[model samples]
Target: MRVGLYPGTFDPVTLGHIDIIERGLALVDRLVIGVAINRDKGPLFDLEERVAMIERECAAITARCGGEIVVHPFENLLIDCAREVGANVIVRGLRAVADFEYEFQMVGMNRALDASIETVFLMADARRQAIASKLVKEIARLGGDVSKFVPPMVKNELLKKFA
Candidate 1:
């Protein structure tokens, strides 16, 4: 089976993320959404909360797309997580030139770490090219509606967190 790993902090998985997940699922037999644990960047939602939100969002997408995509949280090196999940490909979303530059470098490092592993970049949908979790959180924190950007479960969690 062609299993691919899509790793992200996913402070709050957004529609843009769902778009990428849906698109990535098309190219692989199985797609594992790996939620990275980062200590430096404090997240708006706790780790478990973020994982639950992503699970709900991806579940909804899977139901619509009819694909077998697994969502899980990992608190380790991305390559390690990929290895643990028996995945040989890493799927990344590229939004722009800047994103390409950074991802390109990381891909190289990942390749060095595991020569057999490969990285694939999927361009973000034009409509969501500029949407990110940080922006979504900021907008929602300020009482701005982000119903269009995130899933309903995430929106409700944000409302409760900020309330």
Candidate 2:
């Protein structure tokens, strides 16, 4: 079966992320959502909390998508995580030109690590393109409502954490 890896910090998975994952699920037999641990950009939610939040959000989509998606957390190199999961493809979401440039570089690096792994970019829904975890967190921390950007579980967690 063809497996694809979708790796990201997922500080808090957004609806844009869900849209890409849902759309990407159609292209591969199996998709593993890899929640990477990034030490450079400190996250508001810890890895465990971020993983749980992603799991809850992805569970519904996985069920609706016929259970071809799996959510997992990894604290290693993305290519290593992809290899571990037996993935031949890396799925990414493209929001803008800037994203494309950044992802293109990362894709090249990943390809250098594993020549067999290919990167696939899915454009984010126009409306959701502007929504990102970092922006959401910033807004929530300042007492702005982010109910529309993130899942309910994530929204609650953000509120609790920021409150």
Candidate 3:
């Protein structure tokens, strides 16, 4: 069974993230969405909130994709999280040249940590490539409608947060 780990802060799950999860599911028997507690990123939502939001959003996608989707929240190193979940492959979504360059370096370091684990990169869909969590937060903060960028639940949460 090929298990893939897709790790991200997912402060609030966005459409672009769902796109990657759907695409990543195609290559592995099971795709685990590892929601990491990235202190460096200063997430707007708490760990539990992020986990609940992702679980709520991904339920349908997991059913329709014909594969298992596990939304697990973790702490510490990503490589350690992958190992804990028994993931042999790591799924990364590359939005542009800069993303590729950054991911390339991370993959090298991951490989050095564990040669047995492999990294897979999927290009973001053109429509959603520009969507990012930080931008979504900024737009919401400034009273812009982010209903299209994020799930309805997240949009509501963002509104309440700003309200």
Best by TM-score: 3
TM-score of each: 0.96, 0.95, 0.96
Clashes of each: 0, 0, 0
Q: What CA root-mean-square deviation does each model show from the true structure?
A: 1.0, 1.1, 1.0
lDDT of 1 by residue, 73-150 (tens): 888878889999989899999889999989988988888889788999999999999998999989998999999898
Candidate 1 clashes between residue pairs 3 or more apart in a chain or in different chains:
none
- Lowest summed lDDT across 10 adjacent residues in model 1 is found at 67-76
lDDT for predicted candidate 3 compared with the true structure: 0.92
Name the top lDDT candidate. 3
How displaced is residue 146 in candidate 2, in Å? 0.7
**lDDT of each residue in 1-163, candidate 3, tens digit only:** 9999999999889999999999999999999999998888889999998999999878978778778899988887889999999999999998889898889999999999999999999989999989989999999999999998998898999999899
Residue-wise C-alpha lDDT for candidate 2, range 48-70, written one tens digit per residue: 88888878877798778775878
Screening candidate 3 with a backbone cut-off below 3 angstroms (N, C-alpha, C), the clashing residue pairs are none
How good is model 1 by TM-score? 0.96
